[model samples]
Target: MNHAHSWVHAFQDRLDLAPFGSAGLALFALALKFGYDDVASIGIDAVVDGPDDRSVDLVYVDRDQRLAVVAQSYVANTPKGQAKASKAATLRQALSYLIEVDLESLPERLWPAASDLRSALAEGAIDQLYVWFVHNCPSSRNVSNEIRTVGATVTSMIRAHFENSNIDIFADDISSEVLEQLYTDTNTPILVNDKISFITHTTLSFEEKEWQCVIAPIKLSDLKSLYTSHETRLFSANVRDFLGMKAGDSNINHQMQKTISENPQNFFIYNNGITLLTHGVDVFDVPNGKRIDAHGLSIVNGAQTTGTVGTSEIEPPADAFVLARFISTKSGDLIGDVVRYNNRQNAVTASDFRSTDSIQKQLVDQMKRIPNAEYDGGRRGGVSAAIKRRPNLLPSYSVGQALAAVHGDPTVAYNEKSAIWSKDALYSRYFNEQLTARHVVFCYGLLKAVENEKNELRKREHNHEKLTKADIAKLEFYRKRGAVLLLCAAIGECLETIADRVIANRFSLTFGEKDSPEDAAAYWQPTVKAISGLHAHLEKAFSDGLKNQEKVRETLKNFSQIVATLRAPFAEFFKSVENKLS
Candidate 1:
């Protein structure tokens, strides 16, 4: 199947959104642009559309990424040359209501998200603001022109309302073609198919195995042009995309921009330079420097440097040069390895560094014994580790999160993941000698069960299935940010009732050796249903924050008391599946 057909086929299973094709397009685009897990972190609040929703269909805010996405969506009932311009005009109205209106004037339903966007901007925390009109139809001159106006209009609004902010704004029509390209990008690396030839100072070539390498000094101006021409499409081989640079003295990307603006002459020596993966390269002598034409090129590393240079408001010095390392390979496995081992741009890479820990090794061995299980243990690497999905393939960071949320400190799992991997205190707290594959599966499965329940609720809404008032109430509570993680924490506190024993260390609890996370999730479904009915007790905890430890502890305590009275419902299920270590 092609991209659009594939989206139709899998949207229901993976995204839990295929019924309301038009309304769901914004989220579909958001998921395609960013990962779906990140969207879950933001919650169902991100998809706000109904009466008083105004023109905006989606509002996504990630302070950690220093980014926010506000989108309007449409899927034409009759396939047209393009979507109506009126829908595009709605983006302008959405921007005004979100930025210019007073907090009190907006509807109660839209207030929380509108406040989040404005607050993130005011604190100067957000650097990238993406305004998209996502649709299934093709792009047109009129809609494209309207999108351009939307960008210009939002820029003026920010200048007037947030004068201190230097927000980088991008406006685009996320049509089917764009979505198809984004889908294709996940697998196909070389999107910038333009033949690239540039002046080089002293070129060097070498060969090892099935790969060849070419090293040279490439002009920063030339790189800037390459980036200007292709934009983000230049880095399509990288599945993560750019995390968007922040503006501050402490920010590394900002520091890179500072270096280029202040001392361009030393950019070559100061920066780590760019690494290019290519199909072939041709070298020829030029007047002063050698010229090389590189074909099928994508940057495996140093995207930040190229992006810094490309986004510079100032022209780089004429003599400025950065070293470029080009690798040409015929072997596909080597190509994947090249992208895996070399590419490095993430907010959390410390977890991958913990791949060698003894606990992680033991877990890996233990996971192998469990059928249909693959646990990376913080050593998650490359495309295969990223895009592939299965019944119980648990990524390392998620395992860290589940363990943290179930044990204690739900906030650390939800908000402070970097600390979970980096700080020795947090690292040792979750992945210690007591940690095992079975424990990881038990905790991680509980978190997955909560997420699955939330998705099922969303699927019900999308399918227009009639829901009970209690189910509606539960859905509303689950829609809040960090609710799923907090509930995971809450449910962990009530495990004594399910286990029918006084559990000392929750980390020591285990499911059967043959059980995958899926099996554990199945065993815990009764518990999830039991907790799902008690939304009223859990709703009070979010008065503070979903990830707040104090609120989480209070909520967990209250729920434990309430669930102790309801123990009979879940005891039988846990009793049959509980695999206490021998």
Candidate 2:
């Protein structure tokens, strides 16, 4: 069987285990193919019984795009006509229900995902909503038009509800033919200039192994076309991603776009040209100019320029020009060198170079050993595996936050900024062999406990319903501040009181030396008691802050001062506990 057929067979075998059958598998496969993470296959149909499912089968919220995608999958093994009709009916019902129902009123099984979608919509956290119909069978022409019409109706309803929101609906049929094409690696020839031509190559001859270079003036529109056709995969090999233009006026892409808009003819002079890596290239002479055909082309530099020009709302000028240098190499070793050389020209963050770090790998391995703890070092597969195995563990991004918090830099955690951890200076200090995965797991537990305490306190206060709106707002503020202060104070106390002994003994308070389940109960006993004692004092601190709301508010405004103010009290609290224990 071909690659496409193999995929189908594999999915077919797993259909019994899949809650939504083959459709769910197809959605998951599509999500994986597109590099989307954090995909949740919400089995709304299994729990809620109705005429049919009036809810989407899959929901994924893209934080980068600020978009929520709700997808319904239709997998059919029967005749095309019957499949098309069935898919159309399912699509129409799902869209209509989305338009008619308030998300908050959704059934309990669907409530969590629906609540997330609704929250994003209500808070303006998302800019767009994508309603997608994914299917394996081919859709008829009439059914296609029907799908578009239903989509339009739903879009109108959503727009009427949300004043400044955009909604787009898409129907994709993952037919055998389409899947075959997707799986096949076919290279197409590209036209560089009047005299230059580029063709893709799967293999290179011994004679063609020599490096060939070409310098040409390529049109901005052509570059944009390539970017549009390939999307992110075009720059997949590049070290840096296209950092899109920021909303304000501080970004380089913003400035470059402005310049291009103002002077189309002078863009070549204003912007640096892109450097590209290719597997093979051929040079030929033409009447007016030279022709260069290149294979396996990827932009090694100038991703920002290409991204801005291609995706910018303002169209690039017709007269705008960019210089393109094509370097051909057959050796994989040479390709690596080229990538490193080009990327090193610009300043890169420690996070960018983390993939090759030995410490990161060690940390990931250590984290995996922790019971019910998952770590993937932020890789795609790692993150997916971690989430699947231990959904309750902190997200991969929280690794850095936990690190900073435990390392006595709670200011960074309080401010919720990742810059300090991404920088070499601070990351090098804390992320070392000295800090084991056990330390991370312990710190994460403390943070989770504090979060749980805050939630319980909030729920208790809400149940009372005695506070005014202003007072309630003040209480919420205090709750957040109290959680951070308590967590930081607890981490400081743990380090001061226990870290040395634990390190010297090669033992953890949460897990003993053997890392056995039997030792966990004994290990966590005192730790739990310490946390409980700290919680009472933290509650008292919160109560005092609530009594002096104005003073707490002013103090909390400065994150540095808040950390400083909490330190002495936290220290005193720890000392009192130590004295009591003695």
**lDDT (Cα, tens digit) per residue for candidate 1, span 1-582:** 133444544334544344334556676666566544333334445776555679877887766556789988877665456788888989898999899999789865576668778877998977789999988787788999999999999999999999899878999998777877765665576777777998877899998889899999998889889889888777876644554578788677788788788888998898887889887988899898788889978987878788888888877877899999988898876776677567434544557667778888899999999878887766654542343333356867678888898896777876676668878999999889988888888897888788778767767876778999988888777766667787888878877776777888887788888887787787777678667778788777666445467877887898888888877765654554343322
Give the backbone clash total of model 2. 9
lDDT tens readout by residue for model 2, 63-137: 334555666666655524334545554655665554457755654334434545555566666644555555555
Clash totals in order: 0, 9
TM-score of 1: 0.82
The residue pairs found clashing in candidate 1 are: none
**TM-score per candidate, in order?**
0.82, 0.52
Candidate 2 whole-model C-alpha lDDT, 0 to 1: 0.50
| Per-residue error (Å), model 1, residue 14 | 3.8
Residue 479 of model 2 has an lDDT of 31
